[model samples]
Target chain A: MTSQTMRRRFAATTNDLLDTDPRVALTLADIGVGSFNGRNHPDRIINVGIREQLLIGATAGLALAGLRPIAHTYAPFLIERPFEQIKLDLSHQDLGAVLVSIGGSFDAAAEGRTHQAPGDVALMATLPDWTIHVPGHPDEVEAMLRRAATSDDRVYMRLAADTNTSPHPATGELAKIRTGTARGATAVAVGPMLDRVLAATEHLDINVLYAATVRPFDAATLREIAQAPEVILVEPYLEGTSAAEVSHALEDRPHRLLSIGVPNTEHRRYGTRRHHAAAHGLDVGGLRTRIEEFLR
Target chain B: MALTTAPPAVHEYEELGRLMSLMTGDEKHSAAATSTLDVIWALYDQVLRIDPTRLDDPARDRFLLSKGHGPMAYYAVLAAKGFIDLDTLTSFATYESPLGHHPDSNLVPGVEIASGSLGHGLPIAVGLAIGLRARGNPARVYVLLGDGELDEGSNHEAIAVAGRRHLDNLTAIVLDNQSASRGWPGGIQGRFSVEGWAARRVNGRNHEALTQALTTPHDGRPLAVVASTEAGQ
Candidate 1:
């Protein structure tokens, strides 16, 4: 149903992939196992019981054995806890898997600092040749996951409780969503940040670009559509996560960039996701001020 | 990329020593490398069903060196087994050399996983067994862990799951040079036995003992072999 969450959509897509593609398998660390029809393909779905390191190591092993592994868990545990396994086992070994995570940034805000992983994208960027996908809506999860599963490239598919109102095509390229005055600045909205970004830039002259996939960043499109000399990047994860990519895309030209997302500083207080966003200036009003300031 | 025919199982120790000598400098873990020499030799010579000509065969046995520190012995064995040429040993850890301080599967032929980080091999081996079973491939999986490498909590996670899964096709060989800072309580064998693995200890230098223990069937559970070597050897 359209009401399904991103986690549920990921589970459904995984089950279907396991049944349809013999080369596909799933590895879990006792997270999100209840939603899957494990009985149908019991052998392919392995639950390793809260061991994040083994979750990644086993996923690497599956890749080594010529099977495409779908590894899932909460964001911090999946990307941060067993990070060496991701670096050495998958990236270093040249193996491929789809690492799907829930609880993006402060999505588990009430759970406090322990579950939050604002630095996941920043950490992953240190590695080479990984395709990072931040699906904006639950509807985009299936196609992106399917694409990653069928290929042998290393992919990190970020799923979050925060989502946009509608789905955009799950292309790795940046899509020019709204065209503004040619002299206006360009704003790039990544994943769940899109809706807020659209609202933030409402009635402003800047162009809006939607990006579900952040890695292999749509530099070509940005170069093509960036008519203005000023650019703003609003991401769901760390602030300035794609700042370097943007700089690299427009290296020849002189331009100014404003990065707005989660601040590098930690917010120790536990509250609602909205409260966390506002604290970090990621809410619509906060984003509007930053974008306006950058334009000026 | 032509390779020599694998030398027969007999008299591998001396030949291995000769091959190991070619790799000079960067013996960062020489003692650690010496401890695994016989065990690695025995596996390539008599135990594993690997062929240099058929490196990509799906049914071929997989061996993961989780304790990838001091990989001189590993490189020598690969050369002896015809997976790599003898001259490549001289270029070990050099600039642009595929051989590094740790074994990289991408650069080296016949290496299943790139490793140097401790506590990574066994968990990956568990996944390999699970995958091989799912594909109906009869290939067995083996992983070699250093005694010190067990100190890494990641290995414990793998030891628990492989036993619980009853992955009979999986085997873990702990090359115990008594290196763990905090050794396992009641010995390393007990640590695995408690988790339902069929385990035993053997002399590290005995080729017959290693081949026997490695090939032993555990029907409903994975196997663990503690190849004990002298600490300072």
Candidate 2:
């Protein structure tokens, strides 16, 4: 029942891991380690000072030297700016690291487009081997961070300001939160979009599924739970990022999908996060209207 | 199977060049690869405290080839050092060959990173230095980068951060072939000097100069050795 920001929980877990595990190294790009309890080792917790490229390159280097490096910063600087470094230094090198990013989509709406990164998940997906986790709540963030840090696989944990009221501890795959009438259209909510999605489909008789770990795309679970030919995917990132995977999962059956989330166009306006959410038709009322129209 | 030691005479540049020539392919980057011949030989034969037998040793020094496009010299040096079999040199850039246009660390025994993209090695070296230092390991990290690669802002960021952190365990060897669109003002050493790094410009082809430049004590600062050479050797 305890609701907190995913970023706060990420820092807390990372600090704990750094204390217990000497193999763990945390690299920051001028983003100060917030609320981290342990700061004993200066060399391990590196701050590259606004150098996003170095942030990733250093993490790769650390990983190369037999260390589990966790690199974090704002989403754009973390994933978008130094994408090549991630591609070459980590992926191409066959090195592994946990890349945790904050500011999902328009979390920094007041700060404008500079701090936003809706395409991060899609960009990371382009890489052949990356486990992308879009955690909806703090508990999920903590669990996923611990899992990623301990594993040698390439992991990208996306932490954002948005949160669901409660944390579902299920991880590594999709969790069926609510099952509706058989043969009704299925609505899937990814990460932070669960709250708005659950509210939007309150009166509908559709099946609903919640997922935090979107990449490795839980296609099997989705296929098992998808009762009808019609599906609606509501994600917290760029619209239709997971549509292909969903369509591929249900390829044997004819299916129609209504993908809802942040649109492709850049909304240059600066305002609150809610304002941007509403403008993108991601709010409860807007999602309800769109879903109802699609189901009609 | 008894490990056959590489012949003592194999350290000669001619032998290294001969090994390089074994791999016949168009666009082999022969010139670029040959340009770093002396420096690579100096590092492998004289300076680096690593051997093919100790490839997995944690305490052994790390050598990252940043300018990886033309890697004949690297392959030759590794072959000469016995890190890789001499027989594999002929299969360079082939589908079944581990020796590609750029070195892949996963496949190559002594390679520290998979590199071909410009401006990535130095920054990664900085991280390696930090990782080693944190682990209390005394191993030094050396990165070989091309002069053209310095144009990348990522190198500058690494240069600045390494200098600021005083990572003396890290060394960057810039193979200056005068290839950049506009060469650094006041020479390549000046760029490192501005970032509070210990830097020296040496003749790329001179083994003695390279040895001295590479081994020069930097005390608390990271060292940058600018090995100047002709555009194509």
Best by DockQ: 1
> Going through the candidates in order, what fraction of the true interface contacts does each contain?
0.81, 0.84
Model 1, position A168, has a per-residue lDDT of 86
Candidate 1 wrong stretches, greater than 4 Å: A1-3, B1-11
Cα lDDT tens digits for candidate 1, A166-208: 8988878998899988888899999999999999999898889
Task: Report each candidate's C-alpha RMSD, comma-separated, in the order given.
Answer: 2.7, 2.8
User: Which sections of candidate 2 miss by over 4 Å?
Assistant: A1-3, A37-39, B1-11
State the fraction of real interface contacts model 1 keeps.
0.81
Docking class of 2: high
DockQ of candidate 1? 0.82
> CA lDDT of A241 in candidate 2?
91
